[model samples]
Target: MDLQRQIRNGWFFFLKHIFNPLTRRIARTSFGPFAIVRHVGRRSGKQYETPIIVSPAKDGFVIELTYGPDVDWHKNVLAANGCTVVWHGKEFAVDKPEPLDTETGRAAFPPPQQLVLNLLGRKHFEKLTCKKDE
Candidate 1:
């Protein structure tokens, strides 16, 4: 692996295995814009709950790729065709995870969120449309 990927993986290991525990507990209560996306593994057949930061979008939600788009949760969501996201005191079954460019993706966020994304160098984002209730 390249140095950049190695660095990213090291940070990911810390975030997913260590820091996420604290974030998960706080995120579960609907505080902030944190969400728990429940998705199954593509190959392992394991269920995983990944905490992410999201913002309300036109029809669904916009998620910034904090650790970049190569993360496993995003891949899992893509492979599974959808995932359930618990956000802002409600659970939403969202599909159609469309990848967007920095301009379009950042447009979905408020000023504060947009500023943060800019500072973080986040260029890719996903727009997941909420599935309507039957």
Candidate 2:
């Protein structure tokens, strides 16, 4: 893994880190309530799960604004359109990803999540794109 990804993963999973759940509480719940997302990985096709604030995309839901490319989950969804997510313990289908331009496009998150991203980070990729996560 790359250095930045290593650092991010360590801080995220390690309970001792200050930026762990303590500092990132808002991120974990930034979207009012978490929405489960299921996507495969670019390198590994195994299913991965992540929770994030989401909003409507065309007719279906979108996690973040854009999908595709460097974001592993997005790429996975692009390669495989069908995903199953358990929400409230009920499984639901998430359509295959449809790519969007990161710049000059609608943010796919709801207002609450947009506020969270605006206060936290400015990266369009991070705010709009989904990553390979577990």
Candidate 3:
């Protein structure tokens, strides 16, 4: 495998096996802007909910790709074409998972978040739009 792919996989392993468990526990509450994405496994047909930090955009929300686009949940969302997101004490049917360039993605959020994204090397993002009445 390529070196970049290997590094990404290693980071994913740590997040999946370590960070995710702790984040999952804290994501259930309204402590912050944390959201939960409910999606099904592409190959396994298993349901999974993942915690994510999101900021509202004009027509949807911008999901920070902290771990890049290789993560399982991001792939699952793409494969499924849609998913349910629990955010800000409500559930939203989010669709249209599109990866935006760094400039476009950073423009979706406010100044503080944009600065943080830049600092974190988060150039990948998913633009999800809510489906009405879902």
Most accurate candidate by lDDT: 1
* Order of candidate numbers by lDDT, starting with the best: 1, 3, 2
Candidate 3: RMSD over Cα atoms? 3.6
Worst 10 residues of 2 by lDDT: 122-131
Per-residue accuracy of model 3 over 2-114 as CA lDDT, tens digit each = 99999999998998898887777676777655688999999999999898878788778888877788888888988999999887667889895888887988888788878
**Local distance difference test values of all predictions, in order:** 0.86, 0.51, 0.83
Model 1 alpha-carbon drift over 4 Å, by segment: 1-13
TM-score of each: 0.85, 0.51, 0.79
Can you write out model 2's per-residue Cα lDDT over 1-134, one digit (the tens) per residue?
99999997886577345522342354344334345566777577577764544454544555553222465555666677656544345455765655444432236655666667667653343222332344
| Model 1 C-alpha lDDT per residue in residues 1-118, reported as the tens digit of each score | 9999999999979987888987777778967768889999999999998888888888899988787878888899999899998886678999959988889988888888889888
Each candidate's clash count: 0, 2, 0
Model 3 clash pairs are: none
* Candidate that would win on TM-score: 1
Question: How do the candidates rank by TM-score, highest first?
Answer: 1, 3, 2
